[model samples]
Target chain A: MNPRRRRGIRGNTSIVESVRLTKIYGSGDISTVALNDVSFEIQRGEFVLIVGQSGSGKSTLLHMIGLLDKPTGGRILIDGIDATFLSDSDRSEVRRHKIGFIFQAFNLLADLTVVENVMLPMMMIGNGASSAMRGEAELVLGKVGLAKQVEKQANQLSGGQMQRVAVARALVNRPALVLGDEPTGNLDSKSSQDVINLMKELNRELKQTFVIVTHAREAFGNVDRTIVLKDGKIESIE
Target chain B: MDFRLVLATKLLLKRKGNFIASVTALVIGVMVILFNSLIFNGVAEGILRDLADYQFGHVLVSKNDGNFVNEDLQLISYVQTFSYVEAAAPRLGSIAWMNSTEGASLNEVDKIVIIGVDPLRDPKASLLYSTVNEGSFVASRGQLVLGSNVASDLKATVGTRVDVKMVTASGEDAIRQFVVVGISKSPGGLAFDDSAIMTVEDIREITGRERETDQILIKLTDRSFQNELKSRLSNAYAEENLNIQTLEEAGEETLAGIRSGIAFINLVGYFGLLSASFAIVTIMMLMVSNKTKDIGIIKSLGGKSTDVLIIFILQGLIIGSIAALSGFIVGSIVGLYLQSIEFSFGPGLVLEVVYDPVFTLNSSLFSVVLGTGAAVYPALRASKLQPIDAMQHS
Candidate 1:
């Protein structure tokens, strides 16, 4: 390949690329390898599903990609930045500025109202934001279809509503990507379908990238591609 | 972040039980500090006023000659010469035997301060006149005035006859008969409850002593000029061995001891506040542990480590401030209540403890700063929480 064309191909291949990532847990003879030389690429603005049976290293791979965990031996490049070599605070900043996360439990702060939770990230990034930031937060909340329930406390919301609120909070900061770990795990069948459809709609309408981990095939229906992991390694990508 | 503070405040509002407990602890701490200040202020004021009002009269002057007669003469001369000198009176104090005519032989010896005064200037010159509640200064040569406690001990009332025996300047026992025309109390009422007041002529007659007095009481025109008066008197009366005792100097030892006691009380109050800080640490640690999952989520959702730290610390400071303010209010009210009631030390010794407790701007501000400062450790703990580890925490 031409050196310039090779660089271009590598750049276009993925916004995030894991190169020979390995993680070991425990000590001495009891050590277990959670990710065995796992490597993959996730393109920008791509809606992808990472599916696997239990103990398949799927969540571990997602954590490394999210910059929530350190690789034992490997490199993770996020949009050309060498993420593995970043300082703890720098990595955290990268996570904060570039990635949005959704948890299976809809991890909303129980003490905060929906509006406050959505405004939290914007306020924390740096001090001295303009008054218009709040207006932006309300607009984002409205985008997530939570404008009417903006004042509701997190704990008071129904499960489906709470998940939607979490989605709003995630997108409110305008991060480059949304990373969800079984985002619909706690929802009923109908609610689960509704949430996945909303995620898909957001992905298309906002042109924001999404990486969701789910066991339910129906939840992955609108995803452009599916990546499967088996026994601490990528089994297939389709 | 402002939002973090708002969130912290909301959390505090929601957890009303914990919030109350934290505030209560802080209030107790603040009350202790205020109470300590009140007691110290009252005790200090009481001692100062008593010293100023009872014994030391701005300044005291004695002769530089060491000869009783010449010292008294020189003191009187200096008093007349110095413009600042208000009045100077001659006094002779000695242990004397006072016997009743009934001959009960009440062996209890009395110390008689045989005051040889120019009655014209003495009352105005000394604190004695102002403190004399029962009778006027010895009006005639043969008349005497007894301290109230002294009269009560002897079962003698004013207008009764008594024989007073004194060891004169010649070291011989001299006896004289006199009528107790007046009764009075000591200033601030020290233990010297039995004192006999007599004229300079009467004391001179009984002692067979002439032109001699043991001490000279000097009053100054302005108390603030005491230092200048002392220096001038010392220089002018260099021939006589006169020593000047200013009110500020006489009570230095007692005042120092009282100040040390005040310091000890404040130390105790500080210890209480320290324990309250420890209580805050415990509460913050509990809060961090309780909200582990939430912390993890916040971190993952672009929340900086500092944000988590701020939220927790803000909670602690808020609680501390509320508690400290409540304590201030409660302590002041209690101090006021105690001050209003009179407490008796013994018969005829009632003390009205003044409890005018106040929060000085500096002290109050320091307390608030300290309360907030104590939350740092808990905040650091919250900030050090790792996103992945906290997420995995049970």
Candidate 2:
């Protein structure tokens, strides 16, 4: 049996569900629609990619799916729970427990050690820096091949290593879904390929769901599926 | 450790320049407050000491009118019976003309007030013995302790014989000769600096009033008992028509002025702390602006708005603690050094620096609270930041 269909609300396999989502930037004449009635679902444990041109709403959809922003019109469900109308605190709780994020900038606090950066999500979840939490963070870092560099400051790591640390941080809490926005945009071609490959390997090993927004679709080979966007609307799901 | 604390400390360390600047502001403000407290408290203490030691004892007893307090020995004996009464002494005050016989002086005679006291008991009731700079206090008949100024005016020193003329109680002019036994100095600009001290027996003999006293000065075990003792004495001596006054009542105007000055100094000190609070506000605001991306990152890592707020607040607390501790140590050292040096306004008048531990501790705690308060707005701004907006912020 596929692990993607193994977890969630009984028969439901979708980790993220967006229905008729619309996000408009401004009010009247100057207003621009960033997402126009876009609907999509990312199954549990599925490695998915959202590819689009500039201003094509790929990142907008990701933001809606991650619950980082509210949609002007529509609803979002995470693991079969209605997330669109949740209060800010509730949204934060959901984000803390069920989702993790990776940015193109890697966004690691430069002054903190690599292990400390990885421990951030657990810390946010109210698990203080206990020995058990430290062990868990170390175990995650080891999975990302950064066990040797756990004590090094985040800024000292190369682009690929930094992204690996970011990956470790995202997975340290064992979130139900992970969202990445241009995760490899700041890296060289080789480092970018290495990061994507690592994410693919992590997804296969842990059966973790991934939804990445990117323009470089070619680098993300062998993904479970690809959703393309154009003019703030879904063009295809392949 | 909580991650918020760890993050706050790391962020503060990352921006060493800003942290140092904020701490410097608080340090200066705290030091200013502490120094203000030291100088004002010292001045107040010195003035109060002078009033108690030289002008009035802890309490004073006099006749309601200007007449001499008759039967003063009985009054002194009664006052000394109280357990809290450290000592009591009778005093006789009179006006006379004195001229040094050994000096080349014809029109150099000076009019002065004479205060007669018992040599042995007076030292317990007052600081007369400590004020003597040249010779001893009056111990025998015809021996006088001259004020520094009076001695200077008469060209007299210890053992200089002077002739004193005054109207005796029988309405007849009487002249007497006395040798100056001591030269005493008076700080706080009291009348003692221009008068003479003699034994009460000699004063009564010259005035032809064998058993009369102008007033009785009483010293108490502790000055704080002045009010309670005053009330008791007032009731006990109501029929005698006596005027009983505490040291505070005798020098009310001077003490009130000093208290007002201290209040103003305290206001200015707190104002210094307020200015330092503004520095904290500015520094924290700049920190928020610089750490926009970091805020977004933390939020994306599932940090709550409250978490962000606490991180910045913790930063302020850390800065305040360090600065307050540093300022207290520096202020205490400087206060001690000032106390060691003699800063005189006039002869025998010097500035005193006092260090009150409770006051310093409260000032430090107040600084810490103000620092944390100053960071509120900036911390709120950081907490309210949208993750998307912050991540997009350049």
Q: Top model by lDDT, which number?
A: 2
Query: Which prediction has the highest DockQ against the true structure?
Result: 2
Query: All candidates' lDDT scores?
Result: 0.73, 0.85
Clashing pairs in 1: B27-B323, B62-B242, B63-B241, B63-B242, B64-B240, B64-B241, B64-B242, B65-B240, B65-B241, B116-B200
Q: Model 2 residue B332 lDDT? A: 70
In candidate 2, what are the lDDT values of residues B44-79, reduced to their tens digit?
Answer: 777777777876888988888764545777877888
Q: Give the DockQ (C-alpha) for candidate 1.
A: 0.54
Off by over 4 Å in 2: A1-11, A127-129, B95-111, B161-178, B187-191, B201-210, B321-356
TM-score, predicted candidate 1 vs. hidden true structure: 0.86
RMSD each, Å: 4.4, 3.9
Give a tens-digit lDDT track for model 1, residues A122-149. 7767544646666777898887778898
Candidate 1: lDDT of B212? 66
Instruction: List interface RMSDs for the candidates, in order.
Output: 2.2, 1.2
